[model samples]
Target: MKRLPNFVQLKEVGPRDGLQNEKKWISTADKIAWINMLSESGVKEIEFTSFVNPKMIPALSDAREVGKQIKREPGVLYSALVPNMKGLEFALDAGIDAASVFMSASETHNQKNINKTIDATYPVLDKVIREAKQAGKLVTGYVSTVFDCPYEGKINPDQVLRVCENLFASGVDDLSLGDTIGTAVPTQVEQLLEVLMKHYPKEKLILHFHDTRGMAIANIMTAMHYGINRFDSTVGGLGGCPYAPGAAGNVATNDVLYLLHGLGIETGIEEKKIQDAGLFIQSKLGKILPSRSLAYFANAQ
Candidate 1:
């Protein structure tokens, strides 16, 4: 058996990916306060908002204000999703510490989500990556549907490799491979990692899983077996894929913490604090979230 890592790094994406899919409008002030709470939760990184067109994702329409007004904590890296130069400009004006650009491995999904072909999307992302680097902010490239696509079915590993190669060549400091529809299993994860690990170091890779089929934790364990240490999650399982029909939210940070802590791994994050953040957002959404840990804590109380 492979030894699990002693420490793992997690990036919180609740504010951006989490809220982007909600139909109910979350007040900008609530978003800011939730992020401020996360900033103090010992999470080193948070994807606070996306600077996309308000018409595209109205939930985050006030990205600039939330990004600018949040009480940024020391040692916390604040990031925002940027789809183009224009979005990056807004992110810069908001004092973003990092920029996240995304595309899907599936051509069909890329077209549907980004409204651009995979080939056309690269140049757009390349420009964003260049400008973000020039401004001294690290850039993260998110490749969605790395495991499976709702429209395309199982994505060929070669296609994922091609996207990863292009993103790395385009100067992204890190790559986040997303299980967009959460269809991946551990065996498939093992197979894909064997391919990805051949070219990139584990340090440059982060796995983003959505627990749609409850396979995320299993797949994460497989990634850990391959020495992956960085993972992306949302507080309270607050996000779902807008383009992928029937897909669930990103794996809850609370659930991931339970797994990591049960294994005696170090994350430097306090579980109680994360639970509090989850409760805050749950109240705003006015619904009990899908996170098992969050539910357990709420029930236990």
Candidate 2:
């Protein structure tokens, strides 16, 4: 009997989203080690690396090598960030199967983060999407600050839909709407999703949320109620928004898995193994994790 689609797609963005803005630079070996452990824990897709200027983001200085070294298992995906064609080349050379491209829905954040206006960034992002599609690469498009922006307070759903139009026209396979600043609540999530679903397919859209205000899991539950099945999360909540300063990381992997399993939704992620990997990675970084729920399991001796 083929069950109805009642599962969630958990894309582990820890290697890229979680570590990109860390104060201390984690070595390439440690990154590779962490991702390898995550791959074994049944995360369907992992953002394994990024292709960007090392001088700009020293955290992922070894993007090329990290993508090359991570052990890829069957039924699991290894994705990287290709900021441009140059990035696409490096990721292709590293044998990456999928790549994610980023842009912001708010004009203020677009210029602040990428130093370009919305009009200017749109064409460039379109070019990246076109080229990646032509290269037979699975392209995932990310629109950051869908809920709110530190500089541009209260994002409009119309702005989000406009950006989605450009991205879909450019041939993106998956679209991820990000709550980059963690300013979203359950009501806000449901409101934006209502508008987003009218324009985009629910299957290709993913939610990338931050836990700065501690409502990340609640927002996820609200999204579930609205029929959203895919979500982006980090291990042990080990990340923050580079654009949104002082913001917390995405919802924790173990906590989300626990919630999903308790609700009888199949996520295919092993709860204990993921918590264990979170423990291993957090120890290597030597910092207290932000996930209150993960802390209980990680701290229990």
Top-lDDT structure, candidate number: 1
Clashing pairs in 2: none
Over 1-301, each residue of candidate 2 has an lDDT whose tens digit, in order, gives: 2232488989999888888887677888888888999999988999987787777878898998898888888999888887888888888888888889889999999899889998898788788888877878899999999989999899999999898888888888989999998879999998898898887778989999889889999989888887889999999887865454445688888788888898899988888888888888778877767776678986685
What residue pairs are clashing in model 1?
239-249
Candidate number with greatest TM-score: 1
The digit string of per-residue lDDT tens for model 1 on 12-57 reads: 9999989997988889889988999999999999999999998999
TM-score for each predicted model, relative to the true structure: 0.97, 0.95
- Tell me how far candidate 2 lies from the true structure as C-alpha RMSD in angstroms: 2.8
lDDT of 1: 0.93
Q: Model 2 misses residue 231 by how many Å?
A: 0.1
lDDT of each: 0.93, 0.85
Q: Please give the lDDT score at residue 282 for candidate 1.
A: 88
TM-score of 1: 0.97
